[model samples]
Target: MLIFGAAVARDRAWDVAVELAERVGAPVWAAPASERAPFPEDHPLYVGGLPFATGPLAERLRGHDLAVIIGAPVFRYYPYVAGPYLPDGLRLLHITDDPAEAARAPVGDSLVSSAGVAMQMLVGALRRDRREPEALTPQEHRMAPHPPTDATAADAVMSARQLFATLRSACEADTVLVEESPSNLADLHAEWPITEPDSFYTFASGGLGWNLPASVGIALAESDSGRRRAVVAIIGDGSFQYSVQSIWTAAQHGLDILFVVPRNGEYAILKAFAELEDTPGVPGLDIPGIDFVALATAYGCHGVRASTPAEVAAEVAAARDRSGPTLLEVAINAAVPSLL
Candidate 1:
């Protein structure tokens, strides 16, 4: 079994990891922040990204006899859990360039080296006596679409779950996604599984507002390369406000960025956390009465709003066809979504 990290794609050796997975009949994955599966998501052996929690992740890694983790720290966890990193009875191998990460892995044969080089060496060593590899089922596949039948466009709010599921089918396969919308992230993952390397990126830090600026950076890089790729950023309304100034730079350069702001009108994730911990309601949570279209205009970019699934599809399609930066403000429900 092989687990990849964001650094593998950064090194442009994600293909090496994919080849190793195919050779060993193991599924491929990256860290949550690195869900951009180095291999094609449609491949039979391509599993999705691992969860952030140690318990759920340990459960997933339990059955494998040997696990090969490369490029990433043995683990990058959020919300903090204290326990054995890996499940018992699972012998593991960790390969990474960061010596500090190698020294800190709780249980693994740590090898400090380049991930690409290590994988190349392993591939060369395994091909001496070729044999048919065993079969493994891919655990990552799309669920049936569940559109919101009861919702109405007149309400000026769409369901986030419905929005993500519909967005996947609407967007191009090769489109690159920059995600900052934490509310419906699990639904987003289920809807748009990463099929290619560097196709999907999210801020590794648990910070808000980075995705918007980061999207502008990626868009400029692609523009400079003379590529016509659809680079879209999905931001929570709260996060979108964090680095909204960056949009001015994107507009100044005429980068063709499609920024989608899921305006849920509240810090929905924090609201959920308050519920989980049985705390009192928090103040300064709701984000109300900010005209995103006006904000976009002020930044010298085109802007539109969508409250229905059909409108979302139309706006996204139109934005993709354009050659300059556009912001599509999606008025979504304020319902708190569960963390995956």
Candidate 2:
């Protein structure tokens, strides 16, 4: 199967690939890097990135009888090749969140839902034919703490581990979490697993500001269906600012939602990338001293700010007890890497 798309799609597609592989008992092969399928090098099922030409990969696919493409366009780029990438007479199915992509890809079968939902549906359909895997052993479940020696004085306040641990404690079985912390994704994936069908997590698409809006959407969906699930959005300060205006919509609709902002003074991810490049700090990356609490208050929602892990836990607990919309900002150390 060729799974490709935005990073959000990549994250979701991984889950989909896991389910599909288990169902069909087929080894999934991915193409090389293009705009669509940017396969994570660290992942186990990754074949390799697609090259400018597909002749080599197409030859490899000649043995497979069917190809299922998910969350990517039919063909990202031809690179001057005027031939079908699929072997002659091979069956193809495509699935995507975007109907436009499904229409453009011309799939034999198409499903319209987020990648996570699609995976859930596929897993449900395959459940009769498959047995559940064993749960993680207690030893495997043990996670290490963020090493204190690795932290600088300025980095001691709120580490990613602290944030994720606090959230994990507070999360209910039915909670839906929409995450847009690009730099914190690895840490989160390492710490959290989807143990229940109702526990949903989604990240940004190609768009920068999806967390807040997606939380609102999920909240609305839950409320309209009379479900008691909480919709929580975890956003980084840099990404939150992109769609800060969405808070008003949540407040207006009276959606029961919790918004948590991890505030560092700069675009910490980009700053780290700059350090890797051995370049000096880029100007305008630092956004000093913005009042997120007051911004939430202005939008007619409850707001609170916490500078320590304890305070963060307290504020989140208080927000969860409320019936309406609320925003809580946790001030974090910006200098440390967001993921281990």
Candidate of highest lDDT = 1
Please give the lDDT score for candidate 2.
0.61
lDDT of each: 0.74, 0.61
Which portions of model 2 show Cα errors greater than 4 Å? 1-20, 23-69, 73-156, 197-204, 273-279, 336-340
Estimate TM-scores for all models: 0.87, 0.62
| Runs of candidate 1 exceeding 4 Å displacement | 127-156, 276-280
TM-score of 2: 0.62
Per residue, candidate 1 scores C-alpha lDDT tens digits across 168-227 of 778888888988877657556666777677787787746787788999999988878887
Q: Least lDDT summed over 10 consecutive residues: which range in candidate 1?
A: 141-150
lDDT score for residue 197 of model 1: 73
Among all candidates shown, the one with the greatest TM-score: 1
Return the clash pairs for model 2, or none. Answer: 4-37, 5-36, 31-50, 32-49, 32-50, 33-49, 33-50
